[model samples]
Target: MNNNCTEVEDPYIRYVMSQRPFGWNFTDPPVFKPYEFEKVDPFYWVSLMEDNWKVAFYAAAIYIVAIFGLQKFMENRAPFELKKPLFVWNLSLGIFSVIGFVRYVPGFMLVLSQPNGFYRSICIKDGMDLPTGYWTLLFAFSKFWELGDTFYIVLRKRRLVFIQYYHHVVTMIVVWIVGPLVEPISRWYTVLNYGVHSLMYPYFALRAIGIRVPVFIANLITFLQLSQMIIGFTVNMTSLYHQQIGNDCIRYPVSIKAFSLVYGSFILLFGKLFYDSVIKSGRRQKEKKLL
Candidate 1:
């Protein structure tokens, strides 16, 4: 529901907060406060990010270099059996992502609960709550932390696919740059990621501990990954469309288009992965069952 934004400093207004079904006051802007510190400015990282666009480029460069270097270094080395460590690594990430999903998803829903929520969901920046704000920052930095996934792969001499490493490189760069911005569409990014990874990493943790997960559960995660891409592409296009129609809240059309291209590529990548891992395999499994 599009209405005239109320103020220059804080634009949202809460005239009918009583009638709001979710009981969240949409009028007050959400401010991100750190977990236990009042000394820190809540918006400090966001301001820093605005001035440091090149940080993403530098981070990506470092990550790509490290991936290859590790791959080379691990050559001729006996693969380390790191069962306990790998289990801890995946379990920790899975737990962190679970917390993030809980903190962030509610705020995302609150933004969408508003009138014209779809537009606001794509356009408004301050719809996030205080906890979501903190978790968003953590999730951004965690991209680099999650690079350890490749470390495990390389050290264990596992087949490191191009998609595995490439996906990590791109996300680390993009999220480092864009995470603080917390663009309206990033609500979708943050939620889907935390939600999906809540299952994904834990699944890995189980496998790391040598537990066999059901085939359907594994397929569901892959399917959810594909769903995230399709949703990303759609949301970006919708935001771009709103921008074209002159919504000031939509802000950066260029960034929207760039994200669209990124999601478009992912759609193809994940689409193929889904077919090979799920659809095609499902057919073969069914044929086997019949026999």
Candidate 2:
């Protein structure tokens, strides 16, 4: 991490620094001449996200009803073989996630690369008024589309676990809540999610296309999910510690608790998932072999 990052004056960093919405007067002076503020990154993203976070809650409700309704509808019917559609769906999500990861990870990296980067990255409100913000917006909206994943599960007569739906519903709402603010911790959350989906979705695409993905590879995906949950939990606790000690960087104690609870639940859910799929399944396989 460069203590004098402002001194380096990299053009890319300059551009990103110039693009923050809530005014970062980082010496270079965010000029309105050649690089007009609107041209660099639109301001409407923050407004739209902050304004419409409630939409996520409504969407989640609709998603819950639709999934259960679909499940009941499909209970008496033969499962449709929508292999190609599923393949396309997973592949599209994979590509979308990869693009988001590519575009947004660097913003957080840049945050950490700056002086006091780690703390500032955790505390500051680097609003979404940059190129990275666009992808971040898409990442949140993508949750709405992700509800379709459950539809696929229900229609296919696959078991739709509580963790799966619960995670989606809560995530959709929370991402919307924290997205516009782009809280330092939430920034990390978005990056981790993009990274995980980047790997997980492509693997799903391969399976969707009838390719024989290895069991170990599937286990690895679950492992990554568990890792994400643990990391999220740890970060929330760290943020809480900062709050307790009178850190003026952010004032989100209740939000932090909510985030912690969500991540903690995930830790339990994904841990059980890993145990059932990996550890217990491995034991069963060993027992069968011995038999």
Candidate 3:
């Protein structure tokens, strides 16, 4: 890290330093480094996938074929009673989500507490390093594991909603592309996702274990999903506005546009899900009681 704040040419950094107290240097090395992967890069292969569009295309093709193929295969079969395995899977993912939230959020908060840390958090110029990088990489690869979510739906012979599959497909591609790039704003994406998954997976786990979860709790998760999409869209738009003004913030136009489209769609889909699951459902129940 450069100590001479005056020599830093990046407008974002300069702005950060300008907000500091006299003689304070925003360029000073941080007191703590974030967590990092040890022993080996667990995400090495996934990182390689980012190098070519063909890899993503191939993976996506396989994913689509497998989903439809499985659906066809199970057309005449009875639903699998996967209660025990489903419980384990959801519990594991919930734990992982909690771990991700714990590992990354403190570093984020530490940066945000610094002078102009809020701006630094959103427009980090140096890119992700240490534990945050390791976890962010893991977060990206986790999307592949998430594909199994739909598999459970298919094996259980449940109706697979278009929104559910669409979200899974786009997420796999987006994370693969954006994770390796390590845009600063990507922190928002990871943090919000981890936060949601932390709650969501545990809820699913409980249900899988035959614990009766309230319908409202499930509604809350969907609401959180909608909120995440809205916030993600807003963050991307903010970054684009900053880029347009030549603020010297780190910006990736391609990722921003892709996120806009994906999250924009999510807003509509989740909104509909929320209305159908909560509002419409509640109205029908009320009508039932009145009858």
Candidate 4:
């Protein structure tokens, strides 16, 4: 391997790789590698799930029906506390997200630091690198498990808001579509989601266990979610621009459109929720305090 990036013609790639941030060495060999077994690979299994669109659609259909059906069934029954179980569930997800964030992000940053790394990361197959690919595959599969979040809400007789269910449904579909594709741009979504979940789930777990977190912390988490959507939408638009210029970027027209629509709507929905729940409510409390 030449290991010399000067031959690369793309200016963007050269510029990103040359900037060493905070004394981090981008040229160092990767610390992690993809896992494999005797003649079998787990990442392949996750990739295979995306081979058929019906599988994702069917899963989404079942999810919608089950949540609504369970809601109706619970209408006549007393609400379940489920405090302990919910605590454990949230804690587990929090830990998983933390691990994912730690594992994938450094490697991605390292990749970006290499010669022509930005271009390689975006345009090359498996350009996210092996470790990222492995973790990302797991992240995709984990979305299905996260559907349990709604189950807890329903059982506790909490109101199932449209944003809650809509987030779950669309996220599942989007992860399935883009996860296996492993487009370099999709890495931004994975990293953002993992970072948010790492904080959000632990907060949920603490609250479930009777630890009273400040209200502002909850509002902060919601703000982070909204920010993630905005950033994701911005990234997709950038990718679209690169695709238009024929910059050797992987072009997934349908996936790009889906992401734009989903993230764009999420921005609006989350903005409203944040205003209603945080800003408006905080102002009311301030007025009461004054009185």
Report how far residue 127 has shifted in candidate 1, in Å: 2.2
lDDT of each: 0.74, 0.74, 0.76, 0.75
Which scores greater on TM-score, model 1 or model 2?
1
Candidate 3 has what TM-score?
A: 0.83
State the lDDT of candidate 4 residue by residue for 195-283, as single tens digits: 99999999999999899999989999989988999988887887788778877777466668889899999999999988998899999
Candidate 1: give the clashing pairs: 1-115, 1-116
| lDDT score for residue 56 of model 1 | 68
Cα lDDT of candidate 4 equals 0.75
Give the per-residue lDDT of model 1 (tens digit) for 1-291. Answer: 322234212211222111212222223444434255323343665545544556767877887788789889889789989999999999999999998897777778877888988888877665755576667777777887888898898888898888887778777766665554456677788888899999999999999989999999999999999999899889888887786788756435445666776788889999999999999999999999999
What TM-score do all the candidates reach, one by one?
Answer: 0.83, 0.82, 0.83, 0.83
Please report the candidate that would top lDDT against the real structure: 3
The alpha-carbon lDDT assigned to residue 7 of candidate 2 equals 66
Off by over 4 Å in 1: 1-40
Please list the residue runs of candidate 3 whose C-alpha ends up more than 4 Å from where it truly belongs after superposition. 1-49, 126-129, 289-291
